[model samples]
Target chain A: MLTKRIIPCLDIKNGRTVKGVNFLDLRDAGDPVELAAIYAAEGADELVFLDISATEEKRKTLAELVRKVAEKVDIPFTVGGGIAAVEDVEILLHNGADKVSVNSSAVKRPELIDELSGRFGSQCVVVAVDARQVDGQWRVHLVGGKVPTEIPLYEWVTEAERRGAGEILFTSMDHDGTKNGFANEALAHISGLVNIPVIASGGAGEMQHFADAFLKGKADAALAASVFHFKEMEINPLKAFLRAQDIAVRL
Target chain B: MKNIVIIDYGAGNIQSVKFAVERLGHQAVLTDDAATIKKADKVIFPGVGAAGSAMSKLRATGLDRLIPELEQPVLGICLGMQLMCRHSEEGNTSGLGIFDADVLRFPDSVKVPQIGWNRISGLKSDLFDGIRDGEFMYLVHSYYVPDCPEAVAYTSYGIAYASALKKDNFYGVQFHPEKSSTAGAAVLKNFLETVS
Candidate 1:
């Protein structure tokens, strides 16, 4: 049986983790590599390093961080944020990051999906879509879900799958950081529409929220940032809780 | 010291596999050079990506022909496992024919690419030495090889399929042992130390 995955998403800025990670036991919390190693040791199914670096030099620093993490951590990981072109993805993958996620750059150039998948194979290309409800309709948002676009969430995911996306990381801007829950209805809808795996991002508050994401949302994987970072929930116990819920989890 | 060479034909993430070996206190080199691969004591054929292009790359570099003929213990991972089979439903690819089986895609009833951790059981190979049945391993692929005589292990999503296969000098696993954490690291260690 394939078990549901629990991924810890770390927002990296200038090669250091940006979000407030409250691991009291750690010597240095800002070091993304150290945090990643801790997460891997804690049995995180996978890790996502979202590089929010703006300058090109910082991007190089991100790549170096990825190499270090890959060298130390045995588990798989994906790198994202500001991946606009093939070279950006190539450097990351070459540095030992397993997969590369693309968001606004993919929206800016839909063909970018086709090109990355064609070149690196869809398995290594993760298409991340940020969407929120706009006047009763889910509209794709840009600039980290601040700016909205006319593209429907369902329509874009279907197109992304067609464009050879191996997986879809859907973030509901409305549900994100709400501590309410995931966009289950939208996630189920996307799952029904596309053949690829769907990763539910945002709106993760508690263990039950994760269970809801898997049982109700039908998400292949669930990604959370602050909860895992701030030590609100531990991964192993969460997986144990999910397993007790009869949801298959890697224990 | 063993000369471990990871066959790098530019298809998948070979670096992780090399790092796994390094983690086990062994140094392995990544190369497409035929002479180097032939001289290695243990050969790792790891790939991740489409089978057709991977096979094409293997053929282009003449590694396809060189692989089956090598006398050393050869282990293939994921798409590398698929390419070792006779054929794949993906890309209508013809494989290296090392394993007397056919690669297949999972049914639509389940997810397309069976991502995340899955259990492998019915362990019958030294490749699975010290690894318990029902131990979880990370898997990511759309295509798989059905149960066959060469199957050393199996994983079930909707149906039981060959997750790991072995035939004499060649071994293949559908899961990414390098990324499977401790159990994965142990599996790789077994391959390096046990499968001779």
Candidate 2:
């Protein structure tokens, strides 16, 4: 049986981990490579590095950082934030990233997903959707959730799957920082509409939230940032909890 | 101290395999040059993407014929492993026939690509030397090789299947050791140190 994945997301800016990770034994808390190694050692199923400010110069730095992280960590890693073209995906994959996530750029040109999935396998492509509930309907948001689009979340996710997106990372804007819990209602709706694996993102407050995402939302994975960055929850104990709850998690 | 060569047939992430090899204190090189591959201490056939395109690339580079004739130990990863089989239902493609096994797509009941960590047991080869039964390893594939005589380890999804195979100098694993953390690194280390 395939186990549910626990992913730790690191925000990168100017080649340094922007979020202050609270691992005591880490020699350099700001170093993405060191933080990634720590997470791997803690049995994180995967690691995601998001380049918050992905300028051309910063992208080069991210690539170098990816190479450094891949050398030391044996688990799968994903790179995202400003991937706009197949060439960009190529560069990251060549630098040892197992998968690449695309957001605003993929929405700007939906064909970008087709081109990427065609060049690389669909498994290499991850389409991240940021959605917020507006007027009782889930609407897709762009540009870090400041702008909204007419396309409904359901319609956009269905089209993304049709376009060969191997997986969907759905983030609920309303619940993002609230940490109340995951938007299980919305996650279940999206999971029902698509066959690909769905990764529930945002609003992960406690370990039970992860379980709810898997049991109720039917999510294949759960991604969290601040909780892991601040050391509010460690991965091993979380996996143990999930295991005790009859949830299959990689320990 | 070994010169490990990762065969480059223009498919999938060879960089991770190269990095993993180097991380183990061995020099790793990626090349399609026949001479360079022949001279290496060990060879890794790493691949991703459709088997049809991968096999075509191998034939185009003439590595398909050379691979079977090589006497050194060779390890195939994921799609690389499938292409070494007798046949693949993917695109009805013919394989290198190194292992008398056939790759078939998973039934509609389960997820198409069984992605994430799954435990492998019934280990039989040095590839899993120190690895315990039910140790988690990362896997991502739409098709799988059913139980065969060459199987070295087994994993179950909808049915029991050959997760790893060994036939003399040729070895193949459906899982990605490069992405499987400590247990995966141990598998690769075993291949590098024990297979020869």
Candidate 3:
């Protein structure tokens, strides 16, 4: 059977990975190329580098960083953030990102999604939806969870699928930093409705949370931050915990 | 100087493969001309994308029939490897038949595209030299060949499938060694060194 993937997401700013990274190695841990090599050796299934900067200079730096990472690390990696157009997706992909994730851009101009998926097969396109429960309704968040799109979460997910997204990366902003666990109620509901793989994001405080996410929530993969970044948790042990729980993990 | 010819049928990812081989200090020429391919010491058939389209392009250039007759070491990557088989369920297309295997689609229980890095174990030939049994290599394929005598390595995705195969002068891998990092590059390096 196909093994469920374990991904570590690194937020990049000005060609450097932000948060949870120590500046000890090679001046700082923000160097995307060096950080990527380390993660690939640690047996990370996939890596996601989100360019947090919105400026053109920062985007150019991110593209250069992506090229460096692609040269050093030979694994599947995805790039996101500031990806608003098909040209943006093309540039990143050409630079070596195996897949490109679109969030706010897809919501603002859905035609971009259709155009990208058409140009580079659907498998190359990923739709990342950052959601938060607002007054009993799940609402989508844009601009790195700062701006509200007013679009319902489920409706947006369904629309993304119809628009040719290969996978959905759903992040719960409310449960993001808490680590209480994943938003199982929301994920389980989405998994039942979608045919493509659903990757559950946010609220991964412990290894067991991953188990629960796979078993109860039916997530194809889990993306974590603080736990893996701070060394509070390791991928092998987390995968061991999940495997013990009878979940399929690439060991 | 060992000259490695990489077929560029305009249907696959050629730059990465050429770069990977060149990084190891070997010459990898990406070309569609028969003269250059025939003059090379070894040949690499690298591809990505659909099977039918790849075969169509190969046939259009007459390289499909020309490839199997070369008495040199040939390594086929991903879709190129699948095209070497007798037939493929992908696009209901026929193949080079260099190896006696049929490529079948993964059952729905497993995902369509078996994407990501998976461990390849049970080494049986020189192709796996210096490579540990459980070491992981990168893979991204939807159709796989069932067990055959030529299989040098096996990987489990939706089911146990052939990860590496060697038949006489012909060798094939379902994974992309060019994009598989150091280990994958090592595998290609090994093939380059040993394919006399």
| DockQ per candidate | 0.82, 0.73, 0.33
The top-ranked prediction according to DockQ is 1
Candidate 3 docking quality: incorrect, acceptable, medium or high: acceptable
lDDT of 3 by residue, A1-251 (tens): 45788899887777776753221122224567777777777767788987777676976787788777776676678888878777787778767677889988888998877887776656778899998999989999987677877899999988888887878999998888787999999999888777678889989888889988888888888898767777888888788888787887766
Clash pairs of candidate 1?
none
Off by over 4 Å in 2: A19-29
Model 2: per-residue Cα lDDT over A171-217, one tens digit each? 88888877888899989988888877899998988999999999999
Candidate 1: misplaced stretches above 4 Å?
A: A20-29
DockQ agreement of candidate 1 with the native complex: 0.82
Question: If you assessed candidate 1 against the hidden native complex, which CAPRI class would it receive?
Answer: high
TM-score of candidate 3 chain B vs. the reference:
0.97
TM-score of each: 0.96, 0.96, 0.85
Which pairs clash in the backbone of model 3?
A: none
lDDT of each: 0.89, 0.89, 0.81
